[model samples]
Target: MNKTISIIGSGFSALSASCYLAKAGHKVSIYEKNDAVGGRARQLIKDGFTFDIGPSWYWMPDVFEKFFNDFGKSTSDYYQLDKLSPAYKIFFSDDVITIGDHMDQICEEFERIEKGSSKPLRAFIARAQEHYDIAINKVVLKPGISPFELVTKETVTRIDRFFKTISTEVRKKFKNPKLISTLEFPVLFLGAKPSQTPSFYSFMNFADFGLGTWHPKGGMYEIIKAMKTLALSLGV
Candidate 1:
């Protein structure tokens, strides 16, 4: 039987869900308040210059690739990606720390800051990856209808670690405040202070170092166009 689904918003997550559902033979309807699609990924055009109003930064390029690949396509087919140099600039009291645009370079930078830090950084990222798996599989995708859905003996063991303060973890792991701040800033993206954010989000650290930073050549609107194309092709 074909399921009928209505998705609100045309943002990345909404569109992505719509695409997969539609492709799975569902009759999909997307209700977007705005006249155009893309939601937060919408583009802004000005005097011969175009800009992206929100989500100016890009990370986790592979996630984007995976989305496109699911439909027998790749992001390259829709838009060109350029890895940003010095991924971003960080300002601090005494110095400016520039995170590299690549993994090897980031490791080298870490090595310079603290001896034997690079390997620990890699291990930390691995742990974060494990936590990310649990999050995606056990929690995030769940509807959370009951306490039991979110709590269990196994989850109890994991939840404590996730409840710890990000500041305490960062302070304990690395001495470089700049790196710590740079790494921790992503907590804010999820709408929480580092101290308030669950340690589970440390996966963002893995996302930061491992995937590398990227940007579409023209603007993030390129991604929106690609998603719209995919949605239409899927008969959404």
Candidate 2:
């Protein structure tokens, strides 16, 4: 027997749920309060210049790719992704530096900006990659219903990371203020200060420098578009 599923919000998570439920022999319907869907990710078109009005950066391309893959579709089927060469640029009082897409270029930039900094940057990224892999591949699947869901061997071994903040960790690793600030910026996504945000969340740096930043030509809204299309295709 098929069950009827109603998704309350039309945000990314809601749309993704609809697609999954619809594909699982269920009737899925989305109820969005706003006139337009996508919640915060919705676009605003005006004066011949389109505006995303929401998220501009697309982190974790692998996550998006996995979402499409689960639905027997590829992200390329919806929209093309072009990896940004300089992942992003930082403008300071006297100069601007663009973080490059490739690690070599990024390391070179670090070396030029701060002598002997590239080696530590490389080491930091290597450890961050481990955290990234464990968090994404292992921890993300945990159900929030139980605290035990977080009590894995990996989490047990890395328990100390939770107590330390990103700022503390980065400051201990790198001495350059510019580098430390740049590294801290990604943790801002957690809605807390890097000094307050846990070092465990530094996987975001991996998401930044390790995985690299990307844009889906149209806008970040393309992810919502793809999820909506997938839901409809699944007969939601």
- The TM-score values for the models, in the order shown, are 0.83, 0.96
lDDT of each: 0.80, 0.88
Weakest 10 consecutive residues, lDDT, candidate 1? 132-141
Error of 2 at 46 (Å): 1.0
* lDDT digits (tens) for residues 73-155 of candidate 2: 99999998999988889999977778999889889888877899888888888888888888888888666788788778887
Candidate 2 residue-pair clash tally: 0
Query: Where does candidate 2 stray beyond 4 Å?
Result: none
Top candidate on lDDT is 2
lDDT of 2 at 15: 90
